[model samples]
Target chain A: MQGKTGSESWQEVWDKSVNGPRALIDCWQEIPCDPCQEACAQGSIVLSSGICAPPALHAETCNGCGKCVAICPGMAIFLVDRSIGSGLARVTVPYEMRDEIRLGGEAWAVDGEGNYLAEGRITRVSGAGRPGRTMLLTIEVPEEWALKVRGVRGRRKLLEEPEEVEAIEAVEDFAFCRCEEIDYSRLREIITQGEFRSLPALRRFSRAGLGYCQGRFCQSILRSQFLADCPEEDREVESFRVRAPVRPVKLSRLGGEDG
Target chain B: MAFNNFRILQHPVLGEKKNGKEVRIFLDGLPIHAVEGEPIAAALYAAGVRITRLSPHKKEPRGAFCMIGRCTECCMIVDGEPNVRTCRTMVRDGMRVETPRGWME
Candidate 1:
C-alpha cells in the first residue's frame, strides 16, 4: 500500500508463506475501537499496546477469515491471497459504496486517494454474516497491482455529478430562509447593518420570522449571527416572539364555521 | 410530464428506495404522483417543484429548506388550510396542495 503507516508493510506479509489467506490491517490511526480484534476466531489480530493502539496481524496464523474485514468499524482491514493462480492475485476490500458494482462486473480499481490504477473483475460481493452497512468486494487484480489497489470506484461520478456547482458562488446564493427566500448575504446584512439589537426587532424589520414556520427554523441561525456581531452587554436581548396557534389550524376550525 | 431530477434511483448506502403506496396529489391544480405517508415536500422536490411559496412582502420565490419540519419554507395550502408545513405533512391520496402567490390566499 502506498499510504501504509504501520511498522509492518504489506510486502513483508506477502513474502511470508501463509496457509490460506491473511488479513492486512491497514488501520494506521490510534483510535479507540476493537471489534476487529474480537471478530477473529484464531486470535490473529493483536492489539499489544492497548485499546487505542493499531491492531497487528499474525500473518502466519491468520487464515484469511475476513472476520476483521466485516466487523471493522473503520473498514480498514483487507484480505489478500497471492496464491490464487499464476500471475493473478485476489484482494478482498471493504465495500460500502453502493449497488453500482455487482458480482462479475468490471470494476475500476483505485488507490487510497481514489486514483484509477487498473481494471479488475468483481469476483464476489459478500455482505453475509456482517452488518448491512459494510460489504466486502473481492477483486482479481494483476499480481503487481495487488498491493497498490485499495478500493473500487463505484458510483462516484453518478451521485456526485450534480453538486459540481462553484461552492464560493453557491454560498452567496444559498438561501437562509427558504420561505422568505433570504440568501446568506441578505441575512448577514440584516444582522450586522440593521439597527435591530434584539431578534424580535430584526424579525420585525426583515419579516424573517413572520413566515409560515413562525421562526422555528431561522430563529436559531439569526440568533447566532446576531450574537456573533452584537456586543456582550446586548447578548441578553429576547429572541423571536412566539404566538399562539403554534400549529397551523384550519380557518374553518379557527372561525368555528364547520360545526 | 413528471420531474425526475430529485428522484433517487439507487442510493449508494441505502440501496434502492422502498417507497410506500403511490398516491396522487395536486400542486397548484396540477395532478402529481407521490408516495403515500411521505412528506409533501419530498414529493414536490421529486417533481422538481422548487418554489413552493412566495414571500409575502417581496414576492421572492421560496422552496423546501431544512427538509425537517422545523423550516416552514415548504409551507403551502393543504386541503384548504393555509400555512401548512409541507415538509412535515404526509401525502394522502387526492390531497389538494396550492402554492399561494403571496401570504394571503
Candidate 2:
C-alpha cells in the first residue's frame, strides 16, 4: 500500500466485514470501468456513482467469491480472510505474471511498491474457475500482514534495486528529433538566438523534421519547446507541411519495374 | 545473432514470443536471418543494425527511438523504397533493406 489508497482504506474494509472473509476491492483510480460489479453474482460490489467511481464493497454481502478478482481489468481486487486462524490469514490476489508459484511453496510476500514483507506459503493457485487469464494466488501471511501484503515473489527475487548510472548534463542532450538526430540543446540554441522566427523557418533551416520520419515525431516537441520561450500572444505554432506519397512506396514499384 | 542483446528472451506478462516462419533478409547486402511477420526494425535490432539512417543536415547516426510506427526514426530503404518505417513494416522472405546515406541523397 505504498502507492495511493493506503492500508487504512484496506483496514476500513476489514473493519466493515461481518462474515469470515470478504473481497477488498483496492481500485483507487476513478476510471470509467464496471466489469467487477457485473461479475459479482451476489451484488456485493457496486459502483453507485456511475462507472467513473471507485467500487463500493458491501462486505456483508461478499462471500469471498473471488469473482471480482478475476473480472477486474486492473487486477486491483483481492480476497482477504482474517478468520483463517489467530495470527495467520489468507490473502488471495490476481497474478498474471509468467512466473509460477506452486501450491504450498514458500513465497516472499511483497507490498504495493514491491518491498519485501514477511515470507508466506502459497495456499492456492486457482485458474480453473476464473473466467480470463489471471491466476488467483492465495498466500497465507501473518494476520497483521494480510492487509499489507499485496503481491508475492513468483520464482523472481524481490526488492532488487536497479544499478545507478551517471545523469546527463543538459536536458537538451536528450534527443528531440530522433530521425534528424536533433537534441533539445540545438533547438534551444536555435530558438533563443532568433535564427528562425517560426517553426516552418526552423524546420527549413535545421532540417529537423525533414528526415525519414517527415516531422511525425519531433513536430509536437518542437511546438512545445517553441511555445515555452515565446510570448503567449504570438505562440501560434504551425505543423509541418505533409507531402504526398505519405506512405513509403518503393521507387521500383512506382516506376512499374518488376523484381 | 550477435546483436540479440536487446532481444527479450522472456517477458513477465507477454511470455516468450513464438516466432513465425524463419526468413532471410538482406541488410546492406548482408544476409540476416529473421522471423517472418516481425517488424523489420526488430529484425534489424536483433542483427545489431541500430543506426538505420544518417541525418540529412548534420549526417549524424540515427537509430530507432520510438519503436512504434509514429516515430520515423527507424526508417530505412526497404525493397528499394526510401524512407520506409521499418518499425511498422513486417519482414518478409528475401527482403532487401538499405540504410539511406542522407535525406537529400
Highest TM-score scorer: 2
Considering only N, C-alpha and C atoms within 3 Å, which residue pairs clash in candidate 2?
none
Models, CA RMSD each:
5.2, 4.7
Question: How is the predicted docking of candidate 2 categorized under the CAPRI scheme?
Answer: acceptable
Lowest lDDT sum, 10 consecutive residues, model 1 chain A, at A1-10
TM-score of 1: 0.76
For residues A34-117, could you state the per-residue lDDT of candidate 1 as single tens digits?
898788888777777678977877776778878889888887878777877677778888877644777898888878877877
- Could you tell me the TM-score of candidate 2? 0.81
> Every model's DockQ, to 2 decimals?
0.49, 0.42
Clashing pairs in 1: none
Contacts from the true interface found in each model, as a fraction, amount to 0.58, 0.48
Task: Tell me the tens digit of each residue's lDDT in model 2 across A110-200.
Answer: 8888877778899888873333467888888888777777787864753557889999886547666766667778877877777555788
If scored against the real structure, what TM-score would every candidate get? 0.76, 0.81
